[model samples]
Target: MDDKKPLKRHEALKPLSRQHHFGLLFSWKLRKGFAGNISVNRLKAYADWFFVHEIEPHFKLEEDHIFPILGVRDALIVRALKEHRRIERLFHDQDNPKNSLSLLEEELEAHIRFEERVLFAEIQKVATQQELKKIEEIHFEIGSKEEYMDTFWEKN
Candidate 1:
């Protein structure tokens, strides 16, 4: 009776993999806000803040630096890029926070899962040592820990 969990990800993709962890946490936090009956305005404010501080740059890095390794024509790259556009629209949707957040929650999770299970595996397969090293170098400079003044997500 083997009960072993799956093997961890490869070393080269680990940083991006770590970013996915944060992305998933963002989804969970949104879920928590909904469950806790947090205000839509409060959640929207947080979402806007996160889009600026985190999601924007994260998406850029993946598109500009990471995804190009596999070329734009690659089906996975195409799908990822499309999802990025859709997710960006959802985040910035001013007319409908309720619907936008709901869709964002589900789509964001699906996008992360696709990247982790499919896209990243393809990327790792195709990326060279030099390419991976470049990714490592670029990502090492971007730290996630700078604090923001708004603690809306924190318990009051």
Candidate 2:
């Protein structure tokens, strides 16, 4: 049974939430790749591409605009920032690509869930209309719908 209060996301933050949706999909793809015995190097390559095309700019927007609404010292902001750093490290790990990818798969999903379920809720609760409007004005403009060439996650 679910008891958590339902959150209504402000229109301004919808773009970031949409990116969070993609982030969750990325995690699912990693899980599928691992379960299907796809090569670690191949998965790592996809992670690298995703970091550049998606996560980097998403992080930039959050750090630049969203986090400040709650201030850096807020516990939720601290945890969110730390998760971002840890996830970035997992994506960049070269020494144990397999282990890192496995961890990344789990951690990335958890991170997105955290943002969606908790942090964003708090932000919306506290953010003023002007702050949200400023966020909406920032123009996230994430990448197009172009597909990655590798289809390892797909069943042939």
Candidate 3:
């Protein structure tokens, strides 16, 4: 692993960094839900809600605004896109919620790590100031709406 710290993300990309925080929290929530033996349906409901509310838009921003900084032809871009599709499928897989949620927990963490450790670093190295400013202008902060109704993960 690189001992060097990841590059400081520009102000324009900070919104995506915020989304990464939620992505990490999603993984943590899944781990808690699994360990607590929360009902699969309950975990699935949260995953579905998050997929719609957070993940989808976050992925869109990366695809539309961030990845272009590296160009779509970049191998890192290809892998990130493929992972996004796989993660999306796992989140939507109702037939096997247990298996899907387990995979989702692991894959989501891995995807975020790749972006933070590799893809984003590469992007920041290559992105021009004007491109970053454009990203900042279009970025929208996501706000929490209704709280999760179930608190099974908090119980233990």
Kindly report which residue pairs in candidate 1 clash with one another. none
Ranking of all candidate structures by their TM-score, best first: 2, 3, 1
What local lDDT does model 1 show for residue 11? 78
After superposing all C-alphas onto the true structure, candidate 3 shows an RMSD in angstroms of 2.1
The candidate scoring highest on TM-score is 2
Off by over 4 Å in 3: 1-7, 143-145
lDDT of 3 at 131: 87
Stretches > 4 Å off in candidate 1: 1-7, 140-144, 148-156
> What is each predicted model's overall lDDT from 0 to 1?
0.83, 0.91, 0.86
Error of 1 at 116 (Å): 0.7
- For residue 150, model 2's alpha carbon misses the true position, in angstroms, by 0.5
Give the root-mean-square deviation of each candidate in angstroms: 2.3, 1.6, 2.1
Candidate 3 per-residue lDDT, tens place, 23-88, comes to: 999899889988988889889888988988889988987888889888888999999999999999
Task: Quote the lDDT for 23 in model 1.
Answer: 77
Q: Which of the two candidates, 1 or 3, achieves a greater TM-score against the reference?
A: 3
